[model samples]
Structures are given as C-alpha cells and as structure tokens.
Target: MQLGIDQDQADANSRITAIRAAVLLTRSMELWRRERLDPETVLINLAVIAITSERLMRGGLDPKHNSLDVYLPLEKLQGCNVASIAAATGLNRETVRRRVKSLTSAGSLIRTASGDLALPPDKVQERSAQELVRRQLEALVRFANESLRDGVLMLSDEKG
Candidate 1:
C-alpha cells in the first residue's frame, strides 16, 4: 500500500512538471512570435536556430564564444550543418533545408561557407532581442517558482 502511494506521488509529480513545462513553452513561443524574430515560419525556424547553436555550449562554456556580445567569429563558430539539424529535429531533411534557407534569408540565421549555420552576432545584441530574452528568463523563473509551489519540483532544486 505504501509503495503504491509512493509510485502515485512520483507519477503526479511528473505530470505536474509536464503541465508547467508546456505552459511555459507556449508562453515563450508567444513572445518569440511577437518579437517577429522569425516571421517566415514557426517551429522549424525555432528548431533550426536552437539546433545550429548547439556547438557553442555542447562541450563546455567558453565565455569568449558564448557571451551575447562575444559570439564566435563566423569562420570559427562551427555550427551544425543541415544533416545534423535534421537529425536533431527529426524533420525531413528537405523540409529542414527549405526552412534553413528561408530563415537565413530572413536574417534569423547565418549560413557560412562551410555550410554550417549560426545566428548573426548583431541579432542578439540588439536592444529588442535582449529584452525578449530577458522576458523569457523571467518566465523561466516563474515556472520554477510555480513548480516548487505545486510540489512538482524537488525541494533540493530550490535555491535561496
């Protein structure tokens, strides 16, 4: 009986976390769309942006390359290529390719000579972009607080 109750609590916690996460993601997407950062499309554009940027922090954090004001030079960013993006996103390669092209043309992504893709440094440095990021961070903090209040997040995850 006790074991069953423990399992039920675990399952409830997982479901609550998922519910909070979905709401947070929806809010973030709303902010992203309102910013008009990728007017050409939606999920694919966001997916490509996130997938291509994995190189910067995948191994370790390099302050020089990862900071908003200090992104790697175009030649050295080594962002993911189409194949990797498609693999990560599980989208058809052709669809990923088309979206990447569109995003690149829209100035949301930068395709380099090596066929790697990354964001233009100026894209993040702009005041509006930074503001959008700040709002998203605020939403994340709210999500954490809500989760803790709901008992979805472990107390160990809380901080002073």
Candidate 2:
C-alpha cells in the first residue's frame, strides 16, 4: 500500500522542514559558540568539519560504518582543504588558519599531511557527544509529544 500526501500537506511539510533546518542550524551555532567561547572560531571549525564530512560522504564513505578513519582519512578528503573552507565560509584565509590552529591545539581537529583539517572521532570527547545527542533526542521527543497532545497526530490506539 502506498501512502499519499495531498499537495497542501506536501507544501506544509516542506515549509516545516525548512523552518526546522533553520532553527536547528541557528541553535547549533549558538551551542558551539557558547561551548568554545568564540563565535568566529567555533563557526570556522564547524565549517571545516562540515565541509570535510560532506566531501567524504559524497565520495561514498559511510560515516556510520567506517568510523573516523573514513571521514578523516590521512590521504586528505577532496574539497576539504583550508583554502576551500575559507572560500566557502567567506572568512579570511588567515582567520581560518588561526581558528584551525586553535582547534588543533584543543585536540578537536587534526591536520593531515597535506594540511587538510578534519574532526576525527578519536579527537571528540565521548561525554560531550553523548550529551549533545541526548539533548537533541529529548528535544525531538518533546516536540512529538507536544504535537500529539495538541491533536496534531493521533495515538496508534486512538479511535478515529
């Protein structure tokens, strides 16, 4: 059986998805800045990692299965160089370098032999990752429960 959605429902879903993406991105930036104490540095670091991750994923690397070795390969992931990151983020090369240096010193980033930066899983703090994941899951669950309570979705056992 195929599930179908009306045009209006599809449009609403698209709008909701866009809004959620915007909110999530803003909140993620805020959280990173609060944790790092520097918005520029946090943003640059995030950009570097994000660019690197996307490049690797596009190259057929499955992050969920390959671990850090795949994402932060020693051979350098294409399009993840400091220059590309600086260009994509519209940040000065020097500023990107400075933030990359800081992140490297903090052990949250690693530089490959070719000078590409990446966020290896080993460099990440497990507790911090766990906490962030927990917070995100809680937020999603709370949102779903609130929607259910407000009659946006009916419980499985509820009579129509």
By lDDT, the best candidate is 1
TM-score of each: 0.74, 0.59
Q: What is the C-alpha lDDT profile of model 1 across 1-160, one tens digit per residue?
A: 1111234444778877788899998888888889665533556656556765556557665666555655556654555777877776677889878988877888877867787777777876778777887899999989977866665554443334
Judged by whole-model lDDT over C-alpha atoms, candidate 2 comes out at: 0.62
Error of 1 at 124 (Å): 2.3
Q: What is the total number of backbone clashes in candidate 1?
A: 0
Candidates' C-alpha lDDT: 0.69, 0.62
- What does candidate 2's lDDT look like per residue over 1-160, in tens digits? 2222344544556656455557766666666665655777766766766786675667686546464222344454554666877887898989887777777898777776666777665644356655665665665665555444444434454333
* Structure candidate 1, residue pairs in collision: none
What are the clash counts of all predictions, listed in order? 0, 0
Q: Which segments of model 2 are wrong by more than 4 Å?
A: 1-22, 62-73, 134-160
Query: In lDDT terms, how accurate is model 1?
Result: 0.69
Off by over 4 Å in 1: 1-10, 37-42, 64-66, 157-160
Clashing pairs in 2: none
